[model samples]
Each structure stands twice: as structure tokens, then as C-alpha cells.
Target: MNQPASLPLAESLLAAPLPAGGPAWLDAARREHRAAFAAGGLPDTRIEAWKYTALRGLAQRRFADGDAAAAARGVDVAAFALPGVEGPRLVFVNGVFRADLSALEALPAGVSLQPLSQALRGDAEPLRFALSRPALVGHGREAGDAFAQINAARAADGVVLRVAAHAKSIAPVRLVFVGAAADAELAWHARNVIELGEGAELDLVEQHVSLGEQAQLATLVSDIELGDHARLRHVVVQDAAAGANLIRRSGLRLHARAQATLHVLELGGALVRHDLRAELVGDGAQFHTRGVFMPHGRQHIDTQLAIRHQALDTTSSSHWRGVAGDRARGVFRGAIVVAPGADGSDANLSNKNLLLSPAAEIDTKPELEIYADEVKAAHGATVGQLDERSLFYLRSRGIPLGEARALLTAAFCRAMLDDLPNAVLREHLSGLLIAQLPA
Candidate 1:
């Protein structure tokens, strides 16, 4: 990797003064992250990890730092909110927690929820400990990960949801992040932390959208920890503005016998990338991830997933489906690493994509690194278009060519969409997905 002589945007950000409050340790951490960003700089298309996605436009933009005190006017909650998936909502507009637009109804007992900005100002020992944990992210500390470092140094407002031991929260907690409605280009960074105690259970949902066509740069990070025997179901939906550059990364650590199920749907963005990593550190831990990414026009969407098996009898499975139409491009990279002592680990990864047009492109990379002798791991990827036989059969059955193509393409991604636990959300996503297809 070639280092640049100067980084104007990064230098401009670092020239500003740091936040006033926080403990000595946090200040030192921020300084370290800032220094790391300066040393590594922005990643270019030449890098292997970023070969498919380019950051030249993002680096050239002039963006001002986000202001938590800035009021978000004309925010319509009904537009972004789901029809029947309503309960315990937290809305953050331009990286600021909007209390007036939030609803904390039907919260279960033994659950504590608050904004991270408030906790950072007061005594937030738990948050500090969790953030400082070594196993929070598998490989985010590397110098080349500039976005992770920047987020660590500048994150201000986010959610902090913690469940007590042996408790269960049946209602899903929705975290909605809205971008700027104004035309000014703004840079917002936020970090959310979620912790579940032993024998605890909960459902979490996150949605990202924008109100205007502003060229906003939003960086969001999530840190999740599950105690022994804990269970969690996580879902994410990204449909930001047409000109937004969004980078959302999430890392989780699973303890003994812990289980996690994650579902992601990416439908809209100009340049969007998501990095999701999970570490199975204890015996009998299980991690499963599924996603669907569809990009059309001149849009670009990338999904990177890495799972590490560090203990015996651990298991992980990842399945992703993508569809690229028009002149759009899509990428999926999934990696599973089995440690030396992680014998009896089972891992499976599969990625299948469809190219709806001659101009569209899809790139799939599935890899498995196994150092253990007694592990079972398999990885595979496929990039192709709709089956001609199936299309012909549908057309022969009195269906038009366009309708048949759309039906087969939708069915190709239905396996992952059907696994979504929520009926209303699934139905809503199904409708939205079909509407985006080439009609």
C-alpha cells in the first residue's frame, strides 16, 4: 500500500479541538485513533480489501463535523417507520438523539436503555469497559481500517441497551438513523453498544434513511456482547439518500452456549459498505448471518463478513444473495477462520448472485482458513444470471417475458428473505424489493 504525501480532509478534521469531557483513558484512546488515521490515511482501489470499491469521491468531499445540538426540522417519523413493527423506538437525526421524536413504550422489565452521549458525560463505567474490551472487534485495530479509527475518535450520540440476567424482552427495539435534509454536506459518526447478561434474550432492529439528496457521509459502528446462554436476533435495513456515502460496521463476541441470528437487507445508496464481524470465543457458541443486497443504476453496495471460531464445538453459517441491474455493481466477501485449538468447529459459507443486465456486475469471494485438523468447513460462490430453462417454462405458461424474469429473480432471493422472523417487516421488504426489480 502506497502512503499519500498529504490527506487534506483528514488533516482538516484533526485540526479541530477534541471534545471537552470524558475521562483520561478516553482522551488517550481518541488521540491514539486520530494518530492511527493520520498514519494509515484513506484506502485506495489498489488495496486488495478495497479493490472493488473506490473512496475517491468520499475523500474529495468537503464535510463539516456533525453538531449534536443542531435541530432536525421537518422530520417525518411516519415515512420511515414500519406499519406493524412498532415498539420502543429511538430516533437519531444527523447523529443527534431526538427525544421529542422517540417513543419508549412497552419496554420489558430489568432492561436499561439510554443514549450513549448522556452516558459519556456522566459515570459510564460499563460503556468504558465494553469499549476497551480486546475482543469487541476481530480485526478493526489495524492501521488500514481508517473508518473504524475515525469513528472511534469522533463518535458522539448513539444508543446503549443492556438487559439484566435471566430476563427476556419480547418487544423489538428499533434504532432509526436519519441523514440531513439540508443540502450541506455533513460528516456524522456514531457508536452503539449492546450487552445481554446471562440467560437473557432480546430483539434489535436498525434502520438507516435520509430525507434529502444531500451528499452526507455517515459512519456508524455497533459493539455487541452476549453472555453465557444468551440469545439475540439482529436485523438491519439500509436505504439512505441517493447521494449518501454510508459505512456501517458491527462486531460481536459470543460467550459459551450463546446464539446469534443476524439478517441484513441493503436496497439503496450511492456508495454503501457494511463490515460485520463475529468472534465465537466460547465452546458451543453459534453464529448465523444472512443478507440480501440489490443495487441498480450507478449505485454501489458492498458487504464484508468475517467470523472467527476460537473455541471447541463452535459453529457459524453465512448465506448471502445479491442482484445487480442496470450499470450498478455489487460485492460480497465472506471469510471464516478456525483457530488451531478450535477443533470440532463447523463452518459453512455460500454466496449466490444474479446479473440482470449485460452492463451490471457482481463480485463474490468466499474463503475459509482452517488451522484445526478436526474442523468441518466449506465455502463456495456463484455469479450468474437467471436460468434460461425456468424463464422459458414460465413464458410458455402464458407469462410475459418481463414478468417471468422478475418472478424468477425474486424467487432466487426468497430463501433468505423468508428466514426473516417478522411477518410485517418481511412483507414490507418483499414489496419494496419487487418494486426495485427490472419491470
Candidate 2:
């Protein structure tokens, strides 16, 4: 079959030369994944996993490989800093690591943090198992998507973090990805690997921001593993430029007695999609997540979440909220599955959405599949506008109609930030949520 003309991005990427000078195995793996992507091309809406998000627009756009001047890009360091988050930080501009802008001098004794490119330079053997995995296999079938294949083949730099056994970090580690304006449209790929040893505890924050309005294509693939009794608190804030298109996939695995909690805020981008999949592979494992996505103007945001219970007595819970205004659109899918023989598993998911304009749209889907005995699973979703009575009451108190609407919308979205442990950070996030509403 001839490659379609709509897929110029894939064709252009396939024609570019691969990265030079790596281990023979690394080179071979990149070639194999690139071949797989070339054979499959970009997936269409016909695929069940991609029904709500279409790539035809993205496919028609062509992008340069990366920003060669990323290191020289003048970015104000103070712009992307967060309150009460003064710790080890890794900064990347246009998917390239910047040593001068990054702060990695005084990392904790047991914590090892560095960019993937640096780790690959010396003793690349330690990362072989992760970097060499087939892109289209395992992990709830979400990891096998076309974007994952692209990242596996083209990603040259990202974050590599490790925490030793029984060690706890008092401060949170931050990973910042900043998109800067380039002379031409660009495409970048990044791969992140994070592991926590047994009995270790850590807090991680990941942020995506842009220096200015620039049309760019970016793909990120992250693999996280939590050992027995390890605990992780993960937070993500996505506030890219309105012209940027960002796609990301994250896979997490929890072992015995491991607990992982996630808080995410999606508030920017022209077109954005996130695929998050988690596996509870050990007894007594727990996973909890809360997120909010607000797409205003003409932006489109989609989030796909899947959780699988593969062990006895595992528990999982998810709560997500969405608000779309103007002509924007939002999509959310939460799916949970319990394998046979995984008894005593409990899973729950709830998704609520609000439409702020007649032209706005929100799609919410909640699915549950249970083959195990003694399992308790529940899922629900709702799409509607704000209550008229609440708005009326506020307006009667002398508040203008627009102010009342903004107040109600802010309150609706701030519910997702109530449980954040850091007071300063939580307040900052709440302020950002309120700022995102139309005034």
C-alpha cells in the first residue's frame, strides 16, 4: 500500500537520518522501532483507542527534527519556578537538556537524577532493559500506539531518576520542559524512566510550559516502577502555548504494598492528548488519581486512563473533572479491569464535566470489566452545565452575571486540588485554575 499524502509528518521523519554513534544494540532497536512506525504510519479515528482524538490535522503538518539552538535559547529561569519547590531541578528547552539552566549540584545522597542523554553516554548497559523494549507490546495495549513508537525510535534526551532503597527525600524534585519559539516548526521526542526502590518515598513534580506562542509537535513516553512498600506522590501541570500540540503516554507498575497517588492539571495547548495506564501487580497495592482539564477557546484536550488489577486485595480510585468553554472540546475515558482470580479487588471511577458555552462539547466515558470473584467495581460519568440556582443566588448578592459564572466555574474546578499536601503549591495551583476561567 502506498503511504497516504496526509501523513507528511511520518514520511518526513522516516526520510531523516537516524542518530549516529551508539551501542550496536541501541542502534538496532531504534531501527526496528522506526521500521514498525513506518509500516503502521499514524493511527486513524477508526481505532477504538483513538476514536475521540483525530490525527489528520497533525499528520498534514511537517516539522524539523529538533532545535539545534536550544542551549542558546534565552529563557527566564524565574518564569517557570514554583512556590516551595526549591530542590533539584532538570530543565529542557525544545526537548534538549540545558546544563546551565538546570540545578543538579546538591542532590540527596540516595537520589540519582540526570538526563537520559548523559546516562546513555557512559555505562549505557544499565538502561538497556528499559530503552530496548518493543514499543507496541504490553501495558494495557496503550503503550503500543504510534506516538510511543515514534518516541522509542527518535527520543534522544529525557529524565532518568532513581531513589535507593529505604531512602526518603524531604524536598520535591522538579522536571521542567519549556518550549521556545524557533525559526521553523519543530518536532521533538523524549523518554523518561523513573524507579523507586523498596521502602523509598519521594515527591515528583512535572511541568510543561512555553516561552511564547509557537506551533510545535512533542511526544513523551514515561515508564515508572515502584518497588515493594514504596510510595510516590506525582503531580503534573500542563500549560503549553496555545499553538503547541503535545502527546504523552505514561505507564506505571506497583508491587506489593506500594502506594501511588497522582494529581494533574491540564489547562493549555491547541491539541493535547494523554494516555495514562497503571497496573496493580502485587497484593495490597493502591492507586489513586485526581485531575482537572479545562479547554477554552478552540483548544482540544483528551485524557485516557486505564487501570488493571492483577493481584488480590488491590484498590484503585479515580476522580476527574472537565470544563470546556467557547468552541473548545474535551474528552475523558476511564477504564478499569480486574483479571480472573484477582479476588477482593476494589475499583471506583467518577468523571464530571461542565459545558460553559452552547458551542462547547465534552465527552466522558467510564468503563469497567471484572472477571474476578469478590470484586467491587463502580464507574459513573456526568456532562452538564452549572446549576442555574447557584448562579442566580450569587447574582442576587450584587455580583455581575459574568463574575458569578467565573466564580462558579473556578469553584467547580478547584475541587480536584483540595487534597494536595503542600499548602503553598496547592494554593498556587488553585490560583492558576481560577485564572484559567473566562472573566
Candidate 3:
């Protein structure tokens, strides 16, 4: 039983591990990422990217893996069962994608689904290419982030989705991160890569829910690449319980004239962090991201969004809203950067938070860095309690106090979810909002 005296747990988690067999260069990269994942941020203070997270003393609770199959009972997946949700849905229990338990009936043409492990060995060229590309570069590197590195090193499992060019599927593809387990209750790591071909269109709903009672440590990383003129509508749902360690990071790249709009909703988890990024790498493209997080109890939720405008005539917008209740802690950081020569670029980033309890904590940051003077960019942050006038109006209308509060809170998040291209997903997510949020 030895502690690193003054060293921070966050830093320790970044250090390197043993190397893997890959191309020499790739192996070197993996080794480097491994070490980085094992290293630390000395003292694990508020100075790093994890400042607003539950980083202190994390070393004392190193994230571990849980029972592979025993966690199905504890998670709240039963709450989301409803009619009209279509297509093949793959459920991953504790980071292991379960194809046998998935439903892929009536899937559309050109739609191929493979587990990450299966894809890596069979027709995995595209996925391998995408995985090899580092989302973090130069000063843009959260590249040094251990969580990302750890995800990279241990990313042998998870989900892989491939859509062909000019194909369209009405069925919503679901990648459910099921967190139910029994003994050996610990952590799970998931690596997912989704590829959309030129002129392809798809709607995807990603559900993250814990299934069992043991403290679940889950880390998920996704890389999405959009081909020319492609369209994708994505909804990310995070609704863990009061005692789960969740870390998720997604990196997206957009090509010419391609458009992708994403809606993110988070309601639970003891400790949660999301590192989401959208890169506009092509001309005449647009990336829109919207998110709402409502955490109750003593939960901690942190969302960091960075959108890079890498080409000309590209537009990006991000709006994040959160309602913190009980003794919850909420953190939001939204950043937009217009790279040099990315002229005619337009970007807007905003974060708004509502604190419902005296003990609730909220931290919000909106950052805009523009290397191009011609780009139109703006950033704003706001934090406050519910509007008293609105509360009074609800009460005057004979609404119960709790009902009115919940209604108002739900309304604040609707703008972020209602715009989802998939009507079914939008409604399902809306229902999940009230279902997951605490009264």
C-alpha cells in the first residue's frame, strides 16, 4: 500500500503500458499513447483538462473491468422500452458487443454492421484507417490525454457501423452501452468507429445506460467520418445511475458538402465526462451540435466540446444547456476554432446552466479562437437559477410545485432534442428525459 506522495492520480493514469504488435510506426504510436495514458498531471489539480472533473484521489479508485455477463439486471434499460423504435439494435454489455442479443431484422441494403473485433479481422480496412488517424494534433492535442490513449490501447472490442454510398436507411441504428453487472463490478472500455460513405444517409441513437449495482467504470471512444455530401443525424444519450464512472470521447470528421447534426442528452451518473469534437475538414460543410444534461443527487457531469473549422465556407454551431439538481456538480466547456485560411467560416458556441439546489455546483466556459479575421465567431456562457417569474406563472395556473419545476426544466432541454432529424428518436429521447431525470 504505497501512494505517490505528491503525484496526481490523473497523471498516473497517463503512463505507458506494454506495447502491441502492429506496423512499427503504429506500434510506436501505440506505445507512446500507452505511456501518455499512464502518466499524470502532478497533484491532479484544476490546471489540466480534467480540472472540473472528479479527478482528485482517482488513483485510489483505479478504473477496473466488470463481470462480462452478470450486469444485465441493475441497469435501467427496461425504462426505455417502447413501440415504434425500429431496426437492428446492438447492445454492448460492459463493452462487449453482443450480436446474439441484438436485433437486426428488416435492415436496409448497403447497411453493414460488425463488432469492432470482428471488423478488425474481416474487411476492417476502413476502420483500421480511421483508427490510425489521431484526432488530436499539435496544440489541438488533448492528444496527450490518457483516457484517449487507454481507450486506444485496449480498444479491441465494441461496435463498427458501415453505410455505403447513396444508401438510405429509415431504421434507427442503436449502439447501447449497457452497464449491468454482478460480481467483479468494475469498469468497461468501448471503442466504436462509424463510417458513412458518400451520399449516404442514416440516423443513429446511442444509448448509455448502466445495468447493475456495482460501481461501473466505462470508457467509450468513437470516431466518425463523413464522406462527400453525406448526411447523418446522431443522438447521444447518457443516463447512468448515481454510482457509475463514465468517460466517453467522440471525434468526428466532416468532408466536402457533408452535414451532420448531433443532439446529446445526459441525465445521470456519479462521475461523467464527455470529450466531443466535430472537425469540418471540407469546404461548404456544416456541423451543428446541441446538448442538454440534467444531473441529480451528488452526480458530477462534465462536457467538453471543441469544433474546428478547417476549411472555407464552413459553419458550425454548438449550444449546451444543463439543469443541475440536488447536490449535483455540472461542468461545461465549449470551444470553437476557425483555423487559418478558413475564410467565410461562421461559428457560434454557447453554454447555459440552471442550478436547482443551494448546494448544486455549475462551471461553464465558452471559448472561440479565430485565426481568420474574416470568420464570424461568437461564444457565450450563462449560469443561474430558474426564473422566479416563470415559477410563479406555473403555480398561478394551478400546477403543482414539483410538476411545474419539472415541466420548465424539460422545456429548457427540448430545444436541443426536438430538432433531431429522426422523429421517433426525438420523441424517444424526450420521453427518456423525464424518465431518467429525478423528481
* Candidate 2 CA-lDDT value: 0.90
TM-score of 2: 0.97
Give the top-scoring candidate (TM-score): 2
Count steric clashes of candidate 3.
Answer: 27
Estimate every model's Cα lDDT from 0 to 1.
0.83, 0.90, 0.74
Q: Which residue segments of model 3 deviate by more than 4 Å?
A: 1-32, 40-43, 46-48, 66-83, 133-144, 436-438
User: Model 3, 197-315: lDDT tens per residue?
Assistant: 99999888888776546576778888898999999988777877668778888889999999999888888688888889889999988999889988888888889888999999999
- What is the lDDT, from 0 to 100, of the residue 55 in candidate 3? 58
Compute each candidate's TM-score over C-alphas.
0.95, 0.97, 0.88
Candidate 1 residue-wise lDDT, 169-257, digit = tens: 88888889988666567788888999999999988888898887777788888989999999999888888888888888888999999
Off by over 4 Å in 2: 1-6, 137-144
Ranking by TM-score: 2, 1, 3
**What local lDDT score does residue 204 receive in model 1, on the 0 to 100 scale?**
87
